[model samples]
Target: MEATYCAGVLSRGKLPVSNLRKSDHGFQRLTSQRKAIASVSCHLSNGLGESSCKSHGFHGGSYHGGAVGKGKDPILQTRCSAGVSMYGESFLESHSHATEDKIGVLLLNLGGPETLHDVQPFLFNLFADPDIIRLPRLFRFLQWPLAKLISVLRAPKSKEGYAAIGGGSPLRKITDEQAHALKMALEAKNMPVNIYVGMRYWYPFTEEAVQQIKRDKITRLVVLPLYPQFSISTTGSSIRVLQNIFREDACLSRLPVAIIQSWYQREGYVRSMADLIAKELERFPKPEEVMVFFSAHGVPVSYVEDAGDPYKDQMEECIYLIMQELKARGINNDHTLAYQSRVGPVQWLKPYTDEVLVELGQRGVKSLLAVPVSFVSEHIETLEEIDIEYKELALESGIKNWGRVPALNCTSSFITDLADAVIEALPSAKAMTNSEGTSEEMDNDPLRYLVKMFFGSVLAFILLLSPKMVLAFRNHLF
Candidate 1:
């Protein structure tokens, strides 16, 4: 549980020799403390021709080794020495550089089909991920084959969906604008930072961002998954992919990275969303007599029950929190949560957004406000799916007014809220100890240790029971 330390600088595209320090002698003697610990220094080369070397001591004796690169030169070089201390008063100092002390913000997002031609391939990429499908290893092979077959059958119909709005998904364009707006907002605050977009399912993937980070020689990274509400199927999957890639690539693994797992409960976020809703309500003839419908992208029900993904719960919490904010602002009327854009015949979380609109229309709800709560930027889901498709549905159902709250793309308030969320989520930026003893010390704290143990046990039990649960549920439902 002790904090690990590594000190080295890049040299000739490889990690150069560095020194390690032991400072445990200053600590009070304890039975748990062990002496004569060994440490090893290793160099990691990200496949993208970048090398980073790190050195840390373990209980066993330390050793040194070099890694061979596939191309022009050796990728990483490392040397190990015992009883050498490179302790710094501040842990952040170890990673900080004089030239660039700015925080690096990476926006993690899901990229959709860019053009009409890209729609089928984009969906195929999304369905191909094992994390998303959650099928058995053998069945996974069957799943992708089946997915491709279904894609062929669904492409024509899906293409029509794309054509309804335009010939492409608006995700990439909206995301780019969001990134630029965020950058300007941070600059206005004089917060030294660079914002980069890393997509999960399409162009500008996470791997590409990792490579770019290496190329930029960024010292600290703050990864912000764009989902306001987190779920294992989305944010969790992205984090796992990043973790695995970091584990395999040495250069990326060595960099200091912190993830903002979820910010659904952030005050600024909830307030900004409430503000959007409040402004939209003004356009309606009867602001007080409107039904507010929160439409979130739907995932399979099995993912919620079997995988223990907190998406639905988190989404519901978000709606509740936003409603509370609206009430506090004296703008409350009536609101409902519904799931949207469900694919496949399998039942998704309901009431379906479109279906809800129809039923509301039938019930004489003349004016309705549709809010896409899951997504931050306007994409096909908002512009095409909700605006075009759902608009027609509402008209067909004899509802006179159907308006969607604009997506939070590049809005000043939204960008400011995003920056506030990031700053609030991060630990204090002030300098602190870089001693390995601190990690050990914190681990020994009863409260911290208990929480870790509790979560670990719960996760283990869930995994053990997941397969049977998934099978049973699928058998009964499908």
Candidate 2:
């Protein structure tokens, strides 16, 4: 029996798909207009998609699964077993000319400036995101104004960094390469699908990608954030955007969408990071003695403490996985993880990368290797911050020799693993439903909107002015 769930029943954000790199340049990329299909439920043929999601025996780092809904969507559904790799030989065999199965893989990433002039606007877009500044919801209207102020303040130094790295951040260029490579890898496995790059803050924004997906009439979409680990400020922000869009758009809401939350724990990714470290280690005079320094982009401690972001845990586990691979290969020197690119006065995750570098130097550790574990592509963080700034800090701190591991950027092994991740996530794709009505349908209800907003504003004002009243009212109710 095909069970039909109500639209938006797959609640608490599971129905959505989802980073900013969470770098100095990270003021955080991507305001995350990246949210997809709010309140969407699964509609797998024969309930295979739901069952396989659990039967796969993976938790935490797997594709999001949702409750199934009736077909307001027109795409023909099929049984998608976890064990089934139908996207391969059988995919090509059965659907030799299957143009109907339009699968769009939207790769979400932090966008950086293309030139010196773009730096301020890019920063403005980033800081304009509430995730970057993190004010209470009631204060949100001030976001753009404050963002402009901060972006102006931040631009000069940021511009200097960009200038140091040849007048722009190569994030867009490198991300494009990764997208192309991922497409090729998928094509090789006979899973060719259109891949689209959605940068959060730059040109070809997530909104643009969504528009193109609509124009192309994409049947299935895989929202894949390039960030390997999940953070509230990065991946969560993007997911939120997608959810809003899904809620508003009739066509997108009904479209089948699958999201890969994070893939740092994937075997191939760990091995590939190890491969880079191992290859880089050979450069030092004594590979066995060189201390491996894992410098990941930092998020606020409050994100973990208050918001319960899994970033620190996931990052630690990712490093552990890679180090375990290295240990298995008998390359166990010594390693430590530190958080870097912290902005603002508030405390970020520590030990801070710069402070740790100085501490390592004072402790007499020489020939250290800096692995940019958080970022996958060469951007401002990897190129200028780690390569230039941190290197200078290390040399000044008395570290005799310093080496930095490069970003994964279209590496054969890394690209292959990403393709594998996409293939694994395909079985769990859940289509958005039109049963909830379209954005246009909702817009038709203007009086309802005004009443809601008017009351909301009144409530916010009350909360803003009368805390004591709220407390007294609550006590009286009790």
Candidate No. with top TM-score: 2
- lDDT tens per residue, model 2, 22-99: 122221111212112221122121100000001110121111111112222211222111111224343333344433
Model 1 lDDT per residue over 160-216, tens place: 777776777777667767777776676665556667776666665665566556556
Write down the TM-score of every candidate. Answer: 0.69, 0.72
Let me know the TM-score candidate 2 reaches against the reference structure: 0.72
lDDT of 1 at 216: 64
Mark the regions of model 1 whose C-alpha exceeds 4 Å error after superposition.
Answer: 1-102, 428-478
Taking all chains together, the TM-score of candidate 1 against the true structure is 0.69
lDDT values for all models: 0.58, 0.64
Any idea what lDDT model 2 has? 0.64
